[model samples]
Target: MKKRYLVSALLLFSVLSLFIGVTDLTPLDLFSLTEDQAHILWVSRVPRLVSILIAGASISICGLIMQQLTRNKFVSPTTAGTMDSARLGVLVSLMIFTSASPLQKMSIAFLFALLGTFIFMKILDRIKFKDVIFVPLVGLMFGNIISSIATFFAYKNDLIQNMSSWMQGDFSMIMSGRYELMYISIPIMILAYVFANKFTIAGMGEDFSKSLGLNYKTVVNIGLVIVAFVTSSVVLTVGMIPFLGLIIPNIVSIYQGDHLKKNLPHTALLGALFVLFCDIIGRIVIFPYELSISLTVGVIGSGIFVYLLLRSKLGSKSNAS
Candidate 1:
């Protein structure tokens, strides 16, 4: 997809997003905004829009780097246990920190997310049977184990209700002050762009990158750090937006090919557009009522995930034939 078209679509959807909530602000209101309307626009609508775009773009790019480094299409924070571990980290904060500030909680989550992702990478290295789908299937199981532990901890601590809030991805609660932590993803994403070529080189396998004078472990660790930071920030800020990372990168790779640097922007734009579309649908599907983002994205993203799996399988069969 062309950059211009993506930007145009993003701008259009962003405008529409500002107008879609419970309030009745419109483009015409730009000319004559009362104090109440302006307050709502800045404190609610604008922040929501900004956070949506940033969260979408950051998580999708994180997925791209993960897939590149692991050389697996099905691996992402969602699939690879990173998010679950981050959630567990939040639970740990509640149990230990008790009166932890948001920043403190996020710090704990970031560490757990990083540790979980590292373990997943270690599993990838140890297992020689990394089938196209098998790696992420393992990751899914690993995530389930972490989620179960988090759930158990929540039950023991009587924090199940609090933990459940972060389990569901929702933008309905995101306001100006609550979402600034996600800004951390901006610099991490820029670093991802800067390391794009090294990631590409690393994905070719350790020996190949080493032959080129690259320290494969260092580059891979950097990529994982970036992934962990972005994952933790988005989960902490927006809860869990399932499958935004997995499906967007695959869709972009089909038409755009696998050039990491080139595909980064398209992946980011497509992610924002998709999240905006889902948010709009969630808001309008039942009028004043709403579907959580987790539900909407899960349904649509899983459909696409299945399609990608089948398509890959069929392509393999045809090639064999």
Candidate 2:
């Protein structure tokens, strides 16, 4: 999609989001704001909008980076065990450091996410077949194993109720104090942009990278670090938004080509636009009650994922024939 069109849509939705909720607030009320309306606008709706945009854009870009580094369309935080490991990290924080602050919890989660993503990449290296369809399935299985461990520990420690919060993405509780940690992703995103070409080169594979005098291992580590940090931040702030990092980049790649730098803007915009659209649907569909962001994104993203899989399968068949 055109950048102008995406920008316009994003702005329109942002305005609509600010005015939407159980409380009666609108553009006209901006001038004659009641105390309650002002509180709602500043305290709740604005933060939720900001979180949605950041989480969506960042996670989507994280997905793009992983796909590039691993040379697989379907590999993402959801598929690669990054988010699950982050959740496990969160569990670790809760169990071991019961009184840990949010930032500390996020730190712990980031470490585990980094380790988990590294392991997945190692597993990717050993796989003999490396089929497109099979790769993410392997990741899914790996993630489930981590998740199962987290669940087992959560149950044993009587933290299952606490752990459930991070299992699904929700924006209902986001507010000024609660959502600040997500700003960590802003700098991370900029860092990703700076290294975009390096990532693209690394994506070409180690032999090609070394032929061009690139430090293949360092670049790959940097890319993995970026993915892990973003995944942990979003998972900590918003919860596990499955299929986001997987699908958005794939969609962008279809129209924008495989150039990482060129596609960054579109991926970020499209990701934000998608999450905003889903958030709007969740708010209005149940009218007052709301669906979690994970539920809406999962339902929609899974459908898109299936379409991509089928498209890839058909393309491969046609090429063979």
Candidate 3:
């Protein structure tokens, strides 16, 4: 994947996305725009496009960071209970702080997500075997436990409907004011880039990093903070986009190698491209009625994940032979 190819594809999809909707707007409408058409373009489509781009890119990079820090290809916010914890935080906010603003809710979600991620890492430290497949299975179980707790609370509070909304990732409701919190990811992305080298060093191993005078704990903490904050913001704004973080980086790593700085740009581009492609499919598949982004991505990403597992198994057998 060349940068130019990804950029070109992204632009083409973005233009197409701008023109897609129940309300008819076309390429020609750009030149001779009616008030209604212009409003629709500015208010709904553009913001949705922005949200998709930010959420996709941010989550993918967060996955890359996690995989690096944990040295597990499958580790991600989706697998590691970060999103579940954030959802629990959302439920908590609704239950305890009923009138909390979106930012406040996200703040609470961030704390829970951060805590969940830390706990998962501690679990990793205690595990004896640490098989590639086994690690993520544990994460999946951990996440399910957190999700069940959230669901139980939702049922008790009669907020199950509200909880279900955040469970499914959708872009249909995105508009200018509603999607701005995702902009927080931009600065976080920049921070990830700046600390990319340190993260790479930390990923090598804590002993190796300390041998090189790098503060392994600090870099790892920064990486988790970046992951947690971005995950919470995206979950609150766009809902839980599973596997965006898990698969994109692995795909990039297959072609590009594992160096964090080297793979960052490619990971971000492919993440956005994959999400844009999925969003397009969701919109057109039902014509007027759209499927949620979560459904489309989950269906496709899970297939890719299976393929990766099979490939890993085959490679291991070949090496043994």
TM-score of 2: 0.99
TM-score of each: 0.98, 0.99, 0.99
Question: Candidate 1: global Cα-lDDT?
Answer: 0.92
Q: Residues 176-224, candidate 2, lDDT per residue (tens digit)? A: 8999999999999999999999999999999999999999999999999
Query: Where does candidate 2 stray beyond 4 Å?
Result: none
Candidate 3: count the clashes.
Answer: 0
- Residue 119, model 1: lDDT of 95
Candidate no. 1 TM-score: 0.98
- Per-prediction tally of clashes: 0, 0, 0
* Poorly placed runs, candidate 1 (over 4 Å): none
Q: What is the C-alpha lDDT of each candidate?
A: 0.92, 0.94, 0.95
lDDT winner, 1 or 3:
3
The whole-model C-alpha lDDT of candidate 3 against the native structure comes to 0.95
